[model samples]
Target chain A: MRKKRMINKFTLYISLVILTFIFLFPLVWMLVSSLKNEFQIFRDMQSLQAFLPPAPADVEGGYFHNYVAAFQRVDLLRYIVNSLIYTIGIIIFGLIVNSMAGYALARFRFPLAGFWLGVIIATLIIPPESIFLPLYVLVYDLGWVNTYTGLIVPFIANAFAIFLFRQFFLDFPKELEEAAKIDGCSQIGIFFRIIVPLSKPVFATVAIVLFINHWNDFLWPLVVASDESMRTIQIGLQYFMNEPPIKWGQVMAALTVATIPMLLIFAFLQRYYVQGLTHTGSKN
Target chain B: MKGNDSSAEKLENERHFHQTAKKPQLKPTPPPRKKRKLKSQAFREAMTGYFFLAPALVLLGVFLLYPMGAAFYYSFTDFYILTPDDVSFIGLENFKYIVEDAQFRQAFWNTVYFSVIVVPVQLSVALGLALLINKKLRFRVFFRTAFFSPVVMSLVVVSILWTFMYNPNEGLINQLLQTVGIPPQPFLTSPDQAMNSIIVMSVWQGAGFQMMIFLAGLQNIPNHLYEAADIDGASSWQKFWHITLPGLRNIALFIFITISIAAFKLLVQPMIMTQGGPLGTTKSLVYHIYETGFNYRDVGYASAMAVVFTVIVLVITIIQRVLIKEERG
Candidate 1:
């Protein structure tokens, strides 16, 4: 029995290690291959050396050349700044708008409250893809195409974020609100003072999700932001891919640069991100 | 003395009559005033609620609901972006064209095929990974993180990276296959292989997200059920079949529906990697709509397709909701 159990444990570990390798290899390859010269990448394709960085080359600037080349070819810094502006704009505005709406639905007694909540929830069923055409037309009519307003404003009021905030506020203790009310705090004041502070977890969760979402948004920005200077990182990468004679090293470097921030954010907030997503999945 | 008494009695009687008349009128009047105050307070509260909700409601109306309505309307009209003034109603013409368009038909089937193939494959792999990590293990968090890392990466980046990996000659996948003595396959180049390649990459990139949900589901299953099964001398497979599967049913269903919906909206992969390629084998509906609406400048036609697509999604979701509700009942 003891020997059998030991074998089972050994098998489990082996399988896990293999699974881990399978999952991590592509990312690892992308990162490491970014550090190789074009020739080295092609040369090391067949062996374990593909995972290793290049040795010092005499002619090229060696490992960092691809990074420099990628930066030169695309205004990567501009794209990064665009992504940040859109992401931060969405997060800040989304939290305020969605949370306020959520608070009203959760706390206040009002006619048609149920009806309004239902309408908001119903919008969740409408996939954004189906309406992309008209949405683009609307933004164009507003003359918002290729502007920050086009990129950020439409997405700031997410129904999912509102639903999350509403769910959180429903579980919030009413006594705190009662105390604030007795002290002459207005409805909005209580929300700003008491509810928002106590709901930091939900705020973080919503912000992280929204930040990742806006940062990674491709389709909407692809339609709305046609100008080269206004492109986000994802769109920038897509444009990079379209260029002919695709330099594999620089492409890999650009991809690595684009992906690093997300990985770092995920590393730090893995728990909250996982929890938030799972919470959403289960609620649905 | 007799005249004085008569006058005093008459004065007292008149005063009493005036007091009785005033009391009934005052009772009814005060209640109305109090009721008005209460009504106004309620109205004020409702106004505050509306004020708080205005920003989200207006945005949703403009961006989501109004666009949906506009898309429906645009489907009936020839609303080209370039010529804004020449718009005219053309009832059902775009839908008729969509039906007759071979590419649209191909895209519809391609989308269905991709969704049908990818959802189950992704879910099963996620469930398997969830079960694997659910066991007591060393460095479990590390393993979970490793599996889930791809979910954080942008779809565009994933598509680009996979495009490189799908390179027939020097790609890591083919290279690895060659190490095991399998002949190299043209993954993205071949018509037969391109869609499958995208599906494979998609599953790899997407499974981690569902796995985390499954992992959460797995953790929520009480351990005592397994303990009871062990006391009954149940085999490992039996334990999983009896306890784990049933415990995860709702989550599994949720993941299934969501993955199916997401799979149906496939665009970025084909857009970036295949560009609907080799012979339009991987061209999804959304990709087709994008091509029609933007590339071909056929907004009405694309709007028609979008309406049809939205109806299909709505029907599928309603069916799922009904099924879930029935199961719960």
Candidate 2:
């Protein structure tokens, strides 16, 4: 019986290692292929060499060749900046606006608070993708189309962010607020000074969720940022890929650049990001 | 089992957390007084509350709520994007037009098919992985990160990478198949295989997210229950059925409804990789709606589809919530 269980454990470990390899293969493939020229990439495709970096002889440029070419071929820096501006803007403003509302709903005796909470939660069901057409029309009517305003403003007040903040603040220890009040700190001041500082984890979770989400935002940016100057990294990459004579190396390079931030985020903030994901989730 | 009472109680607490709102308000308001100073203080507090709420409320009202109402209204009218001024309310005409639209019908059914297949498969894979990692395994964090790396990459990036890999002529997938003694099969090029190809990629990209949630849910289950089951000589399958499955029911329900809702909005993959494909087999409802609304500028038709899409999501969510409530009762 002991020997039989030992075999089961061995098999389990072997299968898990295989599963891990399968999951990591594409991402590994992307990084490997990006280092080679187009010819070398295709030539190595049939063999296991496809997953390895090119030797010095393979490409005129070194291992970092494609990344350099990616920038020259496309204005990657411009789009990266544009995407960062939009994402950071949304996160900063969203945290303030949503957290205040959440604090109000959780602690204040605001009139119609229940009604508004219900409405906000209901809006969670109607994702932006569903009602985007009319929303676009509204943006168009406001003459904000193809502009930063169109990209950023509509998303600054997220229902999910508000919902999350409210849930977090619901369990917030009120004794801190009362003690702060005794010290003559205003409610708004207490929120900024006390609540925001103590609630870093929840803030990290929301910010990471928004950062990853808006960073990857494709469709909305696709439609809104029609002009070349306004294009986000995803939109720029799509255009770059489809615009004839597709260079596999450069495309891989662009994809790698686009993906690096998220990997960095995952590396540093895995717990908070995971918290964002499991919304109907564990507190721990 | 010995641990049954505590495990059952733990599940009850979870269900209660799901059903109830946050606990009572924290502010301890004194009884109302006719005194002028106290009345003014009450008024000031109410004003501060309103002040805090105003910005988010305005934005949500204008951006989200207004657009939703506008979409419903626009669905009934011939609200052309080109000629916004010339609008006529044509009740159910847009809906009628879409029902007769061959493309929309195909897209609708295709979405339903994708959801029905993808949701269960992705979720089960996620649950299985969660179970694996939840065990006392070495390199748990490393394995979790490896699985989740795909989810970290954007859909556009994934779609592009897969498009290259899915290429029939010289793609890596076909090339690998050839080495493995299997013939190269057309992936995105063949209409029948295109949806299946998309489904495979979709499941791979998405399973990690649900896996995290499942892991969280798994951690919530009491370890004592498993020990008790083992003490009682319960088989692994029996323990899974009696302890694990029951523990994960709520998380499973949440993952199911949420995944299904997201599945219905399948757009970017088909739009980028297949361009709705060799025979338009991969054109999802959202893709078609975008093509119509933006590409064709037929606002009325797309708005109708949007209404239907929202209704579908709303119905699923409501039904799930009510079912949970009923199950709790």
Candidate number with greatest lDDT: 1
Chain A TM-score, each candidate? 0.95, 0.95
Instruction: Please give me the DockQ of candidate 1 compared with the native complex.
Output: 0.74
Q: After TM-score superposition, what is the CA distance of residue B256 in candidate 2 from its true location, in Å?
A: 0.5
Error of 1 at A52 (Å): 2.7
**TM-scores of all models?**
0.94, 0.93
* Candidate 2: Cα lDDT at B182: 92
**TM-score of model 2 vs. true structure:** 0.93
After aligning candidate 2 to the native by TM-score, how far in Å is the CA of A78 from where it should be? 0.8
Candidate 2 wrong stretches, greater than 4 Å = A56-59, A282-284, B1-37
> Which model scores highest in DockQ?
1
Q: For model 2, state the Cα shift of residue B103 in Å.
A: 1.2
